[model samples]
Target: MDDIGEYIAKESIRYAELIVSKLFSAADILETYPRRGTIVPQFMDESIRQLMVDNYRIVYQLAAGDKVNILTVHHGKRLISNTRHFKKKK
Candidate 1:
């Protein structure tokens, strides 16, 4: 995530900041908009869904009691199979 910020900062500092803000905003939206993302069938987990933010994909899951668990934020071009092993950092 820090790498993504650095890459975008090279283009424009404001744009980079905005991108990070949008990422957080997307997460907030998920709290109230859980079904906004579509199911990712490759994982065969219906709870897993992805929300798009520009060229990125904010992958998350719906846990028990409707809690939102953000799994990862990845580039849209990457294959879901490659990210299937991701475990959220503590």
Candidate 2:
């Protein structure tokens, strides 16, 4: 998330801050509405969902006890590959 903000800051600090703030706000909403986001098509798992904020995709996992774990924040156009944080359900 900070990486994105820094990248955007190269152009304008205000724009970067605004984008980061919006990203945080969108993620916070999931605390109250765990299933507020749609299923991530790439994973096909109900627990894993994504929220679109500005041009970024905030990917997260719905854990036990209503906990939402943010997995990553990346450009919308980028593809999410398998990593230590997650494996695509096949």
Candidate 3:
């Protein structure tokens, strides 16, 4: 939005709010269906899955005791493999 200039600052804020609201709604679904999300194509790990919300990918890991840890929320246009959140530990 910064690059898009201040003309649409209000629009940007609204979009952000909408995205966040949808994220929470998706999380609520995970409470009952943890495996609802598909395995992340970047890793193919069953424990790590992702949900798509608008233009973002909601990456998450199924933790112990039925808890879902949100790993990241990244733009769909970018490459996620390079992100530290999914990097291989050295």
Candidate 4:
């Protein structure tokens, strides 16, 4: 949880200064619980949409060791395409 927070904090100041600061108060909360349920899932295995800051969608997956794998952060307008390969920068 600490690692996830740290990574997000460093990744974008906009996300940190504007979003996360007012949101996700502590990563420990996530650790204390098992798994939080999600909504708007088109498929059972592909992905799930979590509401945050009223507009953000946090796309994540759970691993074997209770690890929360954050895959992507996207806005409401452009829904995440249901695809396995997200294009990477060259």
Cα lDDT tens digits for candidate 3, 7-47: 33456867666677777788788988999999988788788
Window of ten residues with lowest summed lDDT in model 2: 81-90
**Sequence-dependent TM-score of model 1:** 0.81
Model 4 agreement with the true structure over 1-90: per-residue lDDT tens digits: 344345667887566565654346422344554255364355455334244444555555554577655556555466667677332213
Off by over 4 Å in 4: 1-16, 22-29, 37-40, 46-51, 85-90
Report the lDDT tens digits of candidate 1 across residue range 1-90. 677788999999998899888988988998777888988766656778888899988888887777888887878898876453443333
Best by the TM-score measure: 2
Tell me how far the alpha carbon of residue 77 in candidate 3 is from the true structure, in angstroms, after superposition: 1.4
Candidate 1 CA-lDDT value? 0.80
lDDT of all predictions: 0.80, 0.90, 0.75, 0.51
* All candidates in order of TM-score, best leading: 2, 1, 3, 4
Q: After superposition, how far is residue 67 of candidate 4 from its true place, in Å?
A: 1.0
**Candidate 4 Cα lDDT to native:** 0.51
Give candidate 2 regions above 4 Å deviation. Answer: 88-90
lDDT of 2 by residue, 1-90 (tens): 889999999999999999999998998899899899989998898988999997899999988899988999999999998787876444
